[model samples]
Target: MSVTQEEDDPFPVDVSLFTDTFCQETVYRLVGQELKIRQVFGANLGVAAPVWDAALFLCHYLGEQSVELSGKRVIELGAGTGVVGILAARLGAVVTLTDLPSVLPQLADNVSANIPSVGWPTAHPTILPLAWGQDHQNFPSEWDLVLCADIIYLPETYPLLLQSLTHLCKSGALVYLSSKMRKEHKTHDFFEEFLQSRFHVELVNCDHGQNIHIYKASLRKDL
Candidate 1:
């Protein structure tokens, strides 16, 4: 998981049409046993792009949607390549792809080029600058779900990241968090802090190889 060793995943990865063996219907393959995503070069403002854990989390999301996400608001915190939010919007959620200000242009460009334009008719994805820990009253609220991937690598940012998660999610809203078990002790620390937060977290099995953990969380207390 030395992301520094590889350049950003080539942009415009195809959103494939996949059908599980048991179900013949085509589902946009956001997550599954086998996963793929389309992403152009990152903003390169620090770093931008999907890492290993992001891929695994997204794969799990594919089969978990029991209801249509149309009109549902989703905010992908730390939306590096904007792929997660893009997949959500592509599924008909009104999505906000939030990241640092420096990452917005690249994310916005990816959204426009891959998904529907921001100004178009139906559910579309847009970008907002949201630094973790800062107030985000302007970011979408009452969101049906919050999606995050690979943002827990830095220990110092854990507090801010959890704080942002609490602020953006409405009561009972679902959150999909995927992180790598790179540093076991640090990972435990994050979960320890996470348990003290307002959300309830549960572990789930994933097809991605070991070292990746996918947790589905929801607000534990009224927001």
Candidate 2:
């Protein structure tokens, strides 16, 4: 997992020479692009978060549809490794990578590494420390899109995640989310109720045998 400093490396090397002790390096392919990712963090109160398969599936769909990502201001909530948000940035969106304060450094590193060198966005993507359900006075008032992946595992976080999404999203903004439907009924029920309250939700696609689902929803009205 350790990345060595090489004089020929194109991207800036801000991460330390040593890899995170608790996390392992993994690779994924999105829209025919290979990306290196970190997995299983000991930090964040021992949460083992990674970019899940559903996220890759969603990314593929976005690519296939030629989604108009250019010049869009995007925010990613609970961005574990910041892959989806980073990909959006690579595709020309102005992305802000966000996670818990403790995890921002690693998330930033991963973003810096995987983002393409060709036609980089004029405004480099930012890494910010944020916790869901908390006050967000310091964050951007609105975003064109709010992207999240694999954040629906915990029952307690469902309400907070929805509240955060509702707070940061602009009027008529799209919210993209991906998750592997868990066994808990509360997770499903939370999404059903939350979508009913403020969004028009639709299932974009689902990967069979993996339980992965991608969804697209738009805010119902200006708050």
Candidate 3:
């Protein structure tokens, strides 16, 4: 689980793993980048909270100099607060930020407030309501990247997430999945299905103490 940092991704490996107190609009200073986002608090806390795994994924993906997200079409599933998607939007990626129907309003609000400053105009950040299992024919399948973090908690969601991941991406699409690996074997169960699927997957990084990992996956070959 040790990460090799050879000046490519200089961000510290000991990133935050847990966050409970929610902020209305917090300006996060990731290793070398800054993102201003709002997390659902007070009565609205029923929907979303700041996720550390999402933060960690951003720190590495954005920090790495070789990784180019500019102009890439990215979609994030279960994008609770839409922080990661907002950051991706800021990085010049046209992102579709999606979640359950109930969470769309708050997620859209955050995306709107952040768009003026950092978003691609040609392919602006879009908000969509996408339940994992439900298929949408209009869903963009030519996405250059599929993004998610800490979504594999529910055992029932294994098939849904896998199906969405496969359906949304065309051949050779890149997927970045992050999660705080829980002991209920949720992540392991997803990996079991992921292994059997046609996508090629690999562990990009792991934080053993936090029981978190970031996995990079791509289609193995043209289908």
Which candidate wins on TM-score? 2
As for lDDT, the candidate ahead, 1 or 2, is 2
Higher-lDDT candidate among 1 and 3? 3
TM-score of each: 0.72, 0.81, 0.79
Candidate 1: lDDT over CA atoms? 0.61
lDDT of 2 by residue, 1-223 (tens): 3344557422223344323546678777776567788765542313425556767777887888777888998888778777788788877899888877666777877876786657466468888877677755567656888887877766656677677777776455788888788877365765688655777788887887988777888877744
With a 3 Å backbone cut-off (N, CA, C), the pairs that clash in candidate 2 are none
Worst 10 residues of 3 by lDDT: 9-18
Query: What C-alpha lDDT values do all the predictions have?
Result: 0.61, 0.71, 0.69
Cα deviation of 129, candidate 2, in Å? 1.4
Output the lDDT of residue 207, model 1.
Answer: 44
- Clash count of each predicted structure: 5, 0, 0
* Residue 27, candidate 2: alpha-carbon lDDT: 77
CA displacement after TM-score superposition, residue 45 of candidate 3 (Å): 6.0
| Best-matching candidate per lDDT | 2
Name model 1 segments beyond 4 Å from true: 1-43, 50-53, 64-68, 116-121
